[model samples]
Target: MTAIQLESASAQSKHEATLPELGLVCITVSQEVRFRTITRTRYLQFDQKERKKALKSIYEDNLQRLNSALTFCEKHSIKLYRMTSNLFPLCDIEDRIGENLLESMSADLAKIGERAAKLGIRMVLHPDQFVVLSSEKPQVVENSINILQTHARIMDMLGLPRSSWALMNIHGGKSGRGKELIEVISQLPENIKSRLTLENDENAYSTSELLEVCQNAGIPLVFDAHHHICHEKLDSYDDESVTEMFYAARETWDNPDYQLVHISNGKDAFKDRKHSDLITDMPSCYREAPWIEVEAKTKEEAIAHLRDWWEGET
Candidate 1:
């Protein structure tokens, strides 16, 4: 299936036509979201048989809920979405039971992928913050690789392209380890490397820093505007400067048209790192980005609010 369908609307006609498709990350805030999980402690308590059963149950439930999530996105006309890293919770642990857990659910995963593709939804994934491939500790690096591999496997099972269009985005962990990061990325299996993307974090790597890493690693950079402002670099969030960064980030992508930009407003102030419930403004720079993932705390509701706000402004 095609990774993404480019929007026909021109950037200048953003208001006159539909605004760039906004993506909802992980869970939804407006309703009861079912992102089930199994703690390591709880898993340890169960017998071998029970552990396998529990893992299977949780994975199945998560897949069912994911189908529901896809349907919700289709109904709302949200063409972009970020799947939860916890979808298969605790399944990545070295001591976990059911080594073939994901394999068992291949049919379910294919169905979800087919549904998403049919609905014209562009799917992406962001593993939790702990996935640090550049860690000084060997075990940490191994564990991180395991986590990333699982994410890549999920994307493959869904039949998504092994490209940035079905990006598995993460931050450039442990700032200043750019060289080590590049080395680690170079060794990654094609499944993980081909679909991998680095994002600028609020405290660690600034846009400029990660941009260099992305360039070296031959991967696309997912620019997070909120993180840029909160970063120590403290550059002006003015339209001209942010737009310049946007364009620079765009060039890193194999296909600039599929570059993914993340958008979210600070909770209390422009510099606050905590995401607010809704986006108060759309950066003029966003016109240069085709797929903008709404990282607001309100999830899909934030996209709805942004749509309303955009319409009102126009």
Candidate 2:
């Protein structure tokens, strides 16, 4: 299987020499070559009798691809990875086939987790945008719970710790519904709640608002510097203000060493929500973060650029 290739020779050499001491930089989903994910539309194409069979086949392929991804990360000395939420497609539907994925694929999941642990890699998941637990509608909230439960089950099968270090990150939905979100979170099982993390978004919750909710819910907050700058309430991107927000978010985590921050440059301007192909300027505040997930369009290539830039400065 094809894997991410570091484009910069200097960056490659630098990582080989000094990556162990530096905090990890993560790449989302796939790099260079995208991993395969099946949509509900494609699943509907299969006949009723064949649907279960098709789902099993797709799931197995996804697990195999995940193993390949872990191998790629180990080879490149990339220690953090955000897994695709579509690893087990259609499993969230009430009447969906292959609902017993944990039982059927237990061995595969265990092996993947073992490989990651042995290689000293950290894995995380970010459920898609539709998981809105704070929605006022009961059905929407119920669906969101179902989706989150599915993610928690997968993490359990992988034998990951029940903590934010292997987080299932999501945005604060429906902006002023912190009370509703906290209530729903209280109802969830410990397995799901322990691994949950709230993040600030460009259009919705600002750093201050999310910090309050995270504090109430007893879960860690993921500080996104780009999102903080985009939100009108906290428009300044100065080092002092950003660093203060970073510290506030850091305090929410159980361990400061497990604190995860997101870094990205806008496609056009500083306030733009669209991520650029490479991160040109990272905040000085983020140097204190333990794990930084690069949100650039170029995926692992962007990480290579950041590594080169970081090495140049230090």
Candidate 3:
């Protein structure tokens, strides 16, 4: 099989004449997002001193990292770029509670989206760790859906074209309660639902499981390599089993829209699910998947590691 899985011609023709480039998820530059220490807490609470420090400090950051990556892409002649944002908090009750961050975020997103468009790049927002549809608490699930609704509005206001520029990366919930998740999705506005895409989680579902859902929901899927490896449901001890899992994910999506995939590395022991630097070295799976975003631990090192793989001598 080819390194990357490909989609059908009909689906490929829907996107712009240009193809999507391999994307890197960024969380490093904004230390507050990745390093959940006192600094982040202070910043999140609107502590002036800490905010000033974070704003002024210019050490390995998301903004600088994005600039460096764009320059690297320019040097390498990469046509399109993809990025993952950790800015879902604006929709969270805690983050936006008694605050107007939602409006501010919407305004800022437009500018950011415009800039990304100018740079021939697209940004996607991946649901954070706490955002889950499988939560037993009805409130938590409601909050997650509320966040999705906010995301759809943000994308709409930012002039993002449907099926491009912005996408919601969701994981299939465990507990075999995906039917509840589907009901929530079904309740979304048609336009918003159009932008919804489901991805296979590490354990909750397999590629086949995700495909089955997509077949019924009429949506797409983003396959995560590391998640697939760490999946408790998938027996990864044997090489043949691994190969079978990979093939199953690859064959799950007959449509091009389902082609996008996430690539990352994890410990074979499945302890800390950190994104390792060995992503590019692994054989590519979501071939012809229009987009591939790296879910690394830190945004800065993520790009650094990706460049090492993309331009490095094999």
Candidate 4:
């Protein structure tokens, strides 16, 4: 039903394919039901051997799906994808699964990365919300570092250069902690630091706050346009602020054209934070960043619909 996956397209479809309109970045296929969606690791019967087996299988499935996703993106002309952090989820027992996993899946990772590289498709990782660096507690920060280290190792295994396309994006955790978060980011290994990007949160860090963090850390900023609409107050952030936000974010990238943005629409008027199944319009402040991750419930299908809609306007 999505516009991107149409079976029968008239002359309009062919003309639309050549237009440079919105950069609709997709995250995996939308048909999660029809697709073999694998989210969590299954410990069949909690048996030790079974647990290890399950972990290996999940890792393999994730990579396969990632390769499949890359192919899907290339076919649909979607260039950017946000990879799932659940790829390994072995952080609970990294001692057991970390190095062993690298050795086991190195080839597959390399091959998959090669596929992505060849197709000129971009990939990124958004570690879940649990990864909080603003916590004053040492263990929480330590755990967060360890998790990102694991993510860095996977990025290395994939042979993705330390760049924005192969980056680890996170939010400014615990409001008023942007400075502290930058200090933590400073201490990270060069490999991890180079690939880190900070995003503005809905309630905590606004466009103005995270801008400083990214500047200090020498990393790019990912502007979530929907969050601005949903969480930012009219009196606080003005049209000029929106313009500055986009400029600051795009400045962080090596090539300004590769700047990434997150786009989504609210499901309802009252619940603006909730992502709608389809995004019908781009924010007025947005001016076609080089890359934009469409944060819609419909996933790839939504990108297709956007493509179809954009073609009509062109």
Candidate 5:
């Protein structure tokens, strides 16, 4: 090859080797809500045969898309990702597919996990807002447990060791009953609890409140910067608080060396809870955030914009 070609290849290798793993910007399965809803509405279909067929078809498609998403993350050097909540819509739909669902999805899931492992791509799973483990109602907690179990199953299928990288974040749940919240999380099966993390919710719980809950529950805290800003539960927070909390979260994990944080911007004129297309400004002392999950509307586009902004500021 020419001298120019050799130099270009060397430079590319050097860049990849030194790329700072500040935080892995992630993208969900699909940015478009309606488009990502690959699963068809099965309740309306009365025939069991048709419903089973639909279920299998949707799951197969979701898994294929999921594999593709993982590939995308690897290509972009995004070391962290949030799996589509509905990747496997029904917890037990695998029953219809004959042999155990985990067994069926094992090969595909393992393949994705292997790819992620090679690239050090951490997968984060967030159940829908409906998961309320600390709710006063027993049914809510029970159902939430079922969801948690499904997440745990996914972790097992991935064969990734029980670590923060395979985090399944849940809010502190109901507003009050702090003790119950701790107790509820404590009661979860060890497998489910192992990869579990408590994220600060905007309306439901404050960062400090959930931090305490996570401490009491013996789990790490996944601080949500946007939620913390919008949270009225606390009077105020400052730069020091951010650093303290960042470390506080770090201490809760076995691998404190790498902490995962969550971030998002408002969709409108100001910083509201709604996720915007991109974050114009970084959160206070964003450097403290070891690993961040950008929950912005535009997903990867938002990350790309933030990277450009971050580079300019630095």
Candidate 6:
């Protein structure tokens, strides 16, 4: 087997001396999976046999990609390995775990959690975009809460601690604003709260605004570099103002237990979310953060960039 080599991002700064774990967005792999799915569509597309075959192939291919990347990291002596929901969901292993559709994902996750423990890999699941906590027509927010609570139940069923291998990445909903955001989180059981993390988003609130809400509610805050920039500038704030907003949130939310964060290249023009190549230009402030996940347009490129950035080679 070829050893996957990873580039180190440590030379750039002392804070990065202990390189934060790195991961690809995996959503980029969507094209590969979708392409194969389309090809398999013509043959037994929805039939149980066909669905099983296609899903199996997708899982194998994705694991191949991850294993290859992990091999690369091993060869280079890199320490971080981050996998987001973007890649895992493509496997559609939801049916393997839990009870109904709501509980379906837990079994798959329990197996994944065990694997992560054995492999020393960190597994983080991004909240599905559709999951939300709002009193709107669709009631996505309530449904999302139910989904998470069920996930909590599933974890318990598997004998996993709430803080075990998996982590839930989430964003506050804009439907009900601040008060509603508090209500959504407050309703969750304490066990669920420990597993749930709130990330900063561009449209909903600035890091400062989110910190204010989470601080009072006792929910941990996640800072997305790009989302902070988009939010500040969307309302006409300049680059300097955006920078100020990001650091401000960092200062307010920084704590020992809630230390993990998301970092990605985002554009000022938010007409469509186009992952920016300027990730190399990440503000100097984030170099010291203990955990940062790199989300890019594609996994291959993200893997390469993170390696380069990690070693200060970029």
Per-candidate clashes, comma-separated: 0, 0, 9, 1, 0, 14
TM-score against truth, every candidate: 0.92, 0.88, 0.66, 0.84, 0.83, 0.66
Q: Candidate 6, after superposition: displacement of residue 9 in Å?
A: 21
Q: Compose the digit string of candidate 6's lDDT tens values, residues 1-314.
A: 10111011121322435655555443344343221233323533466665555566654455455555445545544334554343333232344411333244445544544443444444455667766664454466656776676556644543344542245767776633777777667877776876677777767666777777777677666677667766655532235655565555555443432256676665455423567543545655565555567666665466567667667743
Best by TM-score: 1
101-192: candidate 1 lDDT, tens digit per residue: 88877887888887887777788999898899888888988889988988888888988878887889988888779999999999999999
Question: Which runs in model 1 stand beyond 4 Å of their true positions?
Answer: 1-18, 232-236
Greater TM-score among 2 and 4 belongs to: 2
Which candidate has the highest lDDT of all? 1
lDDT of 3 by residue, 1-314 (tens): 11021122323443753333556554334543331112345457755455444433422243345445555555544434443333333233343431243454455545545555555555466655556776778898877777677666666655565562356777777557767666666776765666677777766787667767766666666666566666644334234554455555555444445456776666354434765544544434444446667555554456566666555544
Q: How accurate locally is residue 193 in candidate 4, as Cα lDDT from 0 to 100?
A: 87
Q: lDDT of each prediction vs. the true structure?
A: 0.81, 0.77, 0.54, 0.70, 0.67, 0.54
Error of 5 at 286 (Å): 2.2
- TM-score for candidate 1, residues paired by index: 0.92
Better of 2 and 3 by TM-score: 2
* Candidate 6 structure lDDT: 0.54
TM-score of 5: 0.83
**lDDT (0-100) at residue 82 of candidate 1?**
90
* lDDT (10s digit) by residue, model 4, range 6-93: 2122113334444422333324445431223333344434566666666777677777777777777777776666777776656346
